[model samples]
Target chain A: MNLIISTLRKDDLYNKKIIENIQKNISNVEIIYTEDMNIKGCIGCNRCWLVTPGICTIKDDYEKLLIKFLQSKQVVFITDLKLGFVSYKLKNIFDRILPLLTMNLRFKNGQMRHYFRYKKHYKMGLIYKGNGNREFLEKWLERVMINLDGTSIGTYNIENEEEILNALINC
Target chain B: MHLLIVSCTPRAKEKSNTDKILDELRKGYEYNGNTTETLYLYKRNEWESIREKFYENDNILFALPLYVECIPGIMAEFLETLKPKQNCNTKIGFLLQSGFAEASQLRCCESYLETLPSLLGCEYNGTLLKGNMFAVSFLGSKMGKQMVEPFYNMGKYYAQNNYFNKEVVNDFAKPEYFSKKEIFLSNVVSPLNKLFMKVFAKKLGCKGSLNDKPYQNYIKR
Candidate 1:
């Protein structure tokens, strides 16, 4: 099983501790870091849908990361709570996923829905490190999960590392 | 009288916060004796043609939803390409809508707020900060309808009286940089943002060009 962790915090001990715990629990996981990947803002261009079906036309890290998204068995995102929402860095990635906003998706329940279709179902997890609005974050997480046709096993606040780790490893 | 409204929502039919505010503004000011024309940027086929339209209009109002903590990328580009002609007498005003209920997003339009009057040589009217009022859950409810009046009044005040005079503008506090958390996010994410957005031209599909990549990356992250 492969896992990917992306976060907007670097060199912070608190965040580092959480990352280390995640790494320890899930061995052989490849991390695609935010600092190294350098994702850009989505310019609201629909080229991903009109020109290139099911793929983002932007040639930068999105293309590379899209491949990572395809290969990974589980996708985990860690975000700092800024005003009760994901940081703008994470928001940019979410915005760029605009290309994936198509309705041609195939759901596992033998029904078709409108979403960026991936070939299979993958487990999704969110680690919100800071104390932001849990309610809002949960709604957003649910929305994004539904779009990808993936199951959202759980969301954890970094303060409860032990509890969250237990949930993640078990799920 | 003709009023030109420039809307910056990416989806043409989608009801973004900006769109919702604009719709309300449009309805409130509809029978005030002017023919209003709306130019949705996402639907505009040509970039330069819109700039040409800007020069042609006398009263121009800009409406955009705040992204991250700033203006959308296309709005910045639109402002940059504007060449205010000698005959251009556009009276400019702004309406900003954002999900976060803070004045921080005002920074996104800092340059436009400062330069619109200087370049266009027109009066800078006041701006309405429609904060957290566009949620679908709030629509058609009395709370939603009543809250819109104050914002409309603010717009009417500015439209009727020039509000961005040097003294008036200066009275407001100078813009602040990102909070400590924002700084951490920007530093970590700006590099990848640059590589993913600029170098690869992944943003080519968008309407306008956001040339100030580095600064924008910092603000965005």
Candidate 2:
């Protein structure tokens, strides 16, 4: 299974265009419109680790999303660049998925990082909708890939819709 | 110079390690006879008023703990609310702390911090990244005082020169990457560390549930 999470505003022209394109070109993929979700930022409670262990204490849409994430073989993030990084909307989702990882630390690629709670390894892809510096985005994504214990197929700007479709289909 | 310190810790002011560092910086700023005002973002009720404070101040320092290898979502949301203006005179600096022992984990987020001042047309004063900060408070005041002395010096220098001292910043972000010796040591100690954590959790009455899957029902569907 494949998952596509898009943070495009509902009224933006690119929102409909990209959704239409993805629907036409991709199959068996679950696409999530982030702007329409009732998601909250991680409050840094540490409850996911201390209180509930592998579960987030806060009850929200993220609980359902995490299950989808773990079951999927690939996950793609589609977001606007805010201050040369992922939008806070998308980042809120990213930060809230701490339950997917265990607090146990390990070394990966010469850096200390949290170990994965689940056994599955998913391929990750990114699509950005704004004019952010590519170098910053690449570095950010590289760190994200490490945390997810996943491999990056690549990151594509929204202008490259055909390439994104190809990447998604191939994944 | 009037310094505006923004504490971005989600924890309450008294319990926050980031605030403890900010307090040290405040002491240094005050000793220099400079005025400092702080806005705590954890106090969500004041965020609207705090948003206005950014435009009023010229020297701004953002102190935050690294969350998931990046700035916390609240800080990102706060940044998103600021309107971009040309020729803005605000000079921005950042203090980033993390639980991880290696300073390299904070490097990726530092890139974002470097770009932030440019996005707002503010001059970049540089960022101070510190790791292994989670242990500072637990180590008690004697050790805590020693650890935060550099931040005090940083604040003192910034108050006098309008920029963080390059040497101090470099020292604060030392051992950017851990050595192979350190890695081997960490590997050897990891199991023991896990066991100790389990014991600690058990003391808190949460031992067996550390790996509880509360959402397992959802996955089964």
Candidate 3:
């Protein structure tokens, strides 16, 4: 399954474009439009890692999305550039996904990382607009994927719709 | 000038590691005759007031826990509300701590934190990166308090100078990577630690298995 999350507005043309392209070119896609959802940011509660284990205590709209994420083999974060990084909407989703990982520390690739709670090999991709401070962001994305034990498929500027489709299709 | 210490930890005040670090720093800052106000961002209703205080102060320090290899999601949202100020003399620095022992786990986030002050039109005060925060459960223990006691000295240095002491920052972010021998030991201990987490969760009265896969069947792999 390919899970594509967009922080774009429900009425935005780019949001529709990305989903339409994914639907046409990809199979078994789960599309999440952030503006249409009401999810709060993670409060740094340790309940997900301790009490419930692989479940967040916040009890918001994110649980349905989290379940979808576990089933996904690939995820593409569709967002706008904000302060040289992904938008807060996309960032909130990333933070809330902490339940997917355990609190235990392990060394992988010479870095300390949380062990996976579930056994799944997932890949991540990014689609964003603008080029403000992209060098750091690209590196950051690679680092985030490394923590997930996944490889980043890379980023696509808004104009490179074909490149994105090709990457997903080939992924 | 007064300092405004902002805590980006979304955990409750009693359970926050960042809050404890800030307490030590504030003690040093106040002892040096510099007054300070510490703000916690977890109080969603107080953001409007927090933003006002942030704008009013010139020396600001954001102390945050490293989550998901970056700033916490709530911190990101709060940052989004801040607009770039022009001709502002506010200087910003960071106290970035991680539970992980290696500096490599925090390098990317540190890079991002370094770029933050400049992007907001504030002077870039250097970030103090440290690892080995370990766990919140142990932070309340006597041994844990001893571990963070050294940050008091950092607070004293900040009171005299606006930024973190460079020598201390270097020392704190130690063992950036590991020796080849340590890597071998890490490989040996990784599985053991995984088992430890399961045991710890059970002791905490966890209602379900630590490795339960409640949503695994959503897609056929």
lDDT tens string, model 1, A29-83?
7776787776766654445643444556567777666555556667777777543
* Tens-digit lDDT track of model 2 for B1-221: 78898998777876677888888888888886789899998888998888789888888999999987789888888888888756678899998998887778888888788888988878899888788777566457788767777778767877777776657766777777888998999999999988876676666567555666665554421
Residue pairs in steric clash, candidate 3?
none
Residue-level lDDT of model 3, residues B1-221, one tens digit each, is 58898999888888887777777778877885789888889888999999998888889999999887788878888988998878989999899888888776788888888888888889888888778876644545676677777788888878787787667787767888888899788788878876777787788788787766666676444
Against the true structure, candidate 3 reaches a TM-score of: 0.92
For model 1, residues B1-221, the per-residue Cα lDDT tens digits are 56688886654545455665566666655546656778877664766777777778777778877543445545544554556567555677777665433344354444335445555556665555545443432254455556555545444444445343434433332222335565466557755744554333434343322231111211110
Which of candidates 1 and 2 is the stronger one according to DockQ? 2
DockQ ranking from best candidate downward: 3, 2, 1
Name the candidate that leads on DockQ: 3
All candidates: DockQ: 0.02, 0.57, 0.66
As for TM-score, the candidate ahead, 1 or 2, is 2
Alpha-carbon runs more than 4 Å astray in model 2? B137-149, B165-167, B205-209, B213-221
- Winner on lDDT between 1 and 2 is 2
Clashes of each: 7, 0, 0
Report the C-alpha lDDT of model 2 over A7-59, residue by residue, as the tens digit: 88767787678778988887877888877778888877666776568878788
lDDT of 2: 0.80
| Model 3 Cα lDDT, one tens digit per residue, A120-146 | 776888999765576777787888887
Name the weakest run of 10 consecutive residues (lDDT summed) in model 1 chain A.
Answer: A103-112
